[model samples]
Target: MTYTGEVTVGGPPDTREAGDLQITKIAVGPMANNAYLLRCALTGEQVLIDAADEAPRLLELIGDGGLARVVTTHRHGDHWQALSAVVEATGAETVAGEDDADELPVPVDVRVRTGARVRVGSCELEVIEIVGHTPGSIVLAYDDPDGITHLFTGDSLFPGGVGRTWSPDDFIRLVNDVETKIFDRFDDDTWFYPGHGDDSTLGAERASVPDWRARGW
Candidate 1:
């Protein structure tokens, strides 16, 4: 009954309640991409992050509540495999990072930059753009009234290290951005949900920053 943030392609989603919001995470596609469905407890307005794959299953999760918007964290094919399908079915507005918006399968209705806010009823998620993994990969931050921070990091970050980068400069840039913009700004109790695999707290991974930087990955 606990929310572990571990999910398989066909497994039931993991849901967590944070103040006025309900966060549901499910894995889909062969790449095991994680798609998050955020519902506003106050008004029942919903928003989805990454329509990764499995349109039918994602739709089932959406159910009769309908979806207001779909935010794609990056332009990676795996992350938006079902974007067009899901959007067509739900009529949800498409949101993505400004630099990567054009690369998605569907037209991006909202091109967001760092510090931009997306709404779900009365709740708001601030966008943080992290380069390297993709030109405009984003991480959404939700500051709950209950004194918790929840981050949905696309491929820009993971449990043990940051996302994969093609060059040394990119790796450095990614790590620096993550440290300054994310780690430094948020507290240790901040919980992060990655694009793939499990989730971890900043405190749990804080000590490994130097190690991750030294490896140059």
Candidate 2:
């Protein structure tokens, strides 16, 4: 059996209205980490996905209150570095996959398992545990009331590449998971947003997967 986790990234928000969920990408840290600010359209509930490693700079971006949650994609230093500070400053609870949940010093308010959902305002978020990038890497997908689905693939999948797998076992497992689980589940139009680089879609990459596996990357 293969692990099943798929994501579909949708188009960007055209309007930033009071009830429109918008995601702003902030490229920060030495590694050029892409931290995200997910603003809720209805209750104005906002969440941070992988805070800025440069603490001072991140604080400046969402300086004030209103941060509802801090969702860590994984336990990497670059991703979790600002978790504690952000939670303290914004009074937001932290959430992550159960396997890597311990990465946070403090207990995570929500432990995401496969098929778990997180709803904020008018947007609903789905969690998919994607290992191999790390033991506990996961992807996030947000579906608006209008039926647009967007994926937030952490370090699992990339634009022109996939996350490096030092072990052959891990590599094969990860690849199979993405193929049988993710790529097989979604439609061709599903959008893909990786942790690094720009976005792609399941439909676009699904066609090239054979070539991808052929290269043994």
Candidate 3:
């Protein structure tokens, strides 16, 4: 039921939980990168979104979620500096885009790309490749049981504004893509959780897209 590429240092088979999808955030490393643990409601199977640092805390939270996977939205060490420690906890598979697989901080067990789904029990996630902040950056979207779309934007979109392109060309492309691709897809009320800061909705960002573009941030 899961894609197993090369054998990696860690990975646990997916285990189903009998509750609801639960999301927990643990701030890791000096940068305060938010590491998220998503537990499937139907199956306790869980996935760690990031593992920057603070191994002790991350482990404590994932105590029994049967952590099966570690996923990185981009190549930044800030997003997965604690790869070794997390792997020890779950022996879980690691996933990232094929484009940047070679550059991954740790070995990858799964290489995913646009339109592919990463499933956890009854929950299925749609991957949206957003390549401005990092060459292999992605935004994960899933429809909760409530039918609400939730976006785990990684370092992509954020409250008040979008992520700054590390380069000029990346910035222009990132901005344009947000308008033409993302905004056109999600409803205004969809919730967004960036790699950092407060969560916001697509509508709020859409209303300010013009201003954001004009300010050139």
Candidate 4:
């Protein structure tokens, strides 16, 4: 996928091709929510993550290719502001975590749990349910044949620390999930895409986990 000129919110959408997957990132809405389009280069099947905002722009990215599914990272309003519009325009199925599915404005087509596999073309993205950001916050992990892993973390993990939590218990749960489910399972080269900001890698954030947990954030 190629894009030119200014994007909906950020300067330009970031695109990376890893093996069979072509990932494109676009910032949308006043909140600068990151919406991603993951396409399988081999089969041309596409899946969108977080229809954050600016439906027309996201639809433009999909173009004539059509979208098979749109996955919401969590139930936050900012993440799904454009969800209804995009689904209406493309008739794509909606997928969300089972715990957060009922909180969404529209009915969820597929309620995914941790370890569930979401198919994109011939590729399969494993679902990891990480709570704290929300009771059902989740991240999508795709292990490429090349041995690199691509993570789509909603608001669960970020560059310097994990997602914000209101209580210490929530923070602990998120931290544990990040360490066990994400950090431990993937290698340092694992690339993580976040919901509202730039991307980060597990290698970059690995060493800082201890500090983040100590500070209790």
Best by TM-score: 1
- Candidate 4 weakest ten by summed lDDT: 1-10
State each model's CA lDDT, in order: 0.95, 0.70, 0.73, 0.90
Candidate 1 per-residue lDDT over residues 1-217, each given as its tens digit: 8889989999999999999999999999789999999999999999999999999999999999999999999998999999999999999999999999999999999999999999999999999999888889999999998879999999888999999999998898899989999999999999999999999999999999999999996
Per-residue error (Å), model 3, residue 23: 1.7
Quote the RMSD, in angstroms, for model 4: 2.4
> What tens-digit string does per-residue lDDT give for candidate 4 at 90-137?
999999999999998878999999989998998999999999989999
In model 2, the Cα lDDT at residue 181 comes to 60
Better of 2 and 4 by lDDT: 4
* Clashing residue pairs, backbone N/CA/C < 3 A, model 2: 9-150, 9-151, 9-191, 19-41
- Model 4 ranges off by over 4 Å: 1-10
**Model 1 TM-score (2 dp):** 0.99
Highest-scoring model, lDDT: 1
Q: Which stretches of candidate 1 lie over 4 Å from their true place?
A: none
Q: Model 3, stretches more than 4 Å misplaced?
A: 1-19
Q: TM-score rank, highest first?
A: 1, 4, 3, 2
Model 3 lDDT per residue over 58-90, tens place: 787788657788888888877777878889777
The backbone clash count of each candidate, in order, is 0, 4, 10, 0
CA displacement after TM-score superposition, residue 46 of candidate 1 (Å): 0.6
The alpha-carbon lDDT assigned to residue 77 of candidate 2 equals: 75
> What lDDT tens digits, residue by residue, belong to model 2 across residues 1-217?
2211221122221212222667666666467666777777566677777874766666766656478787888877777777777777778878888888887665799999879987665677888887777787788887555545677887888866567787877777778777876788777776666665566778778877777676674
lDDT of 2: 0.70
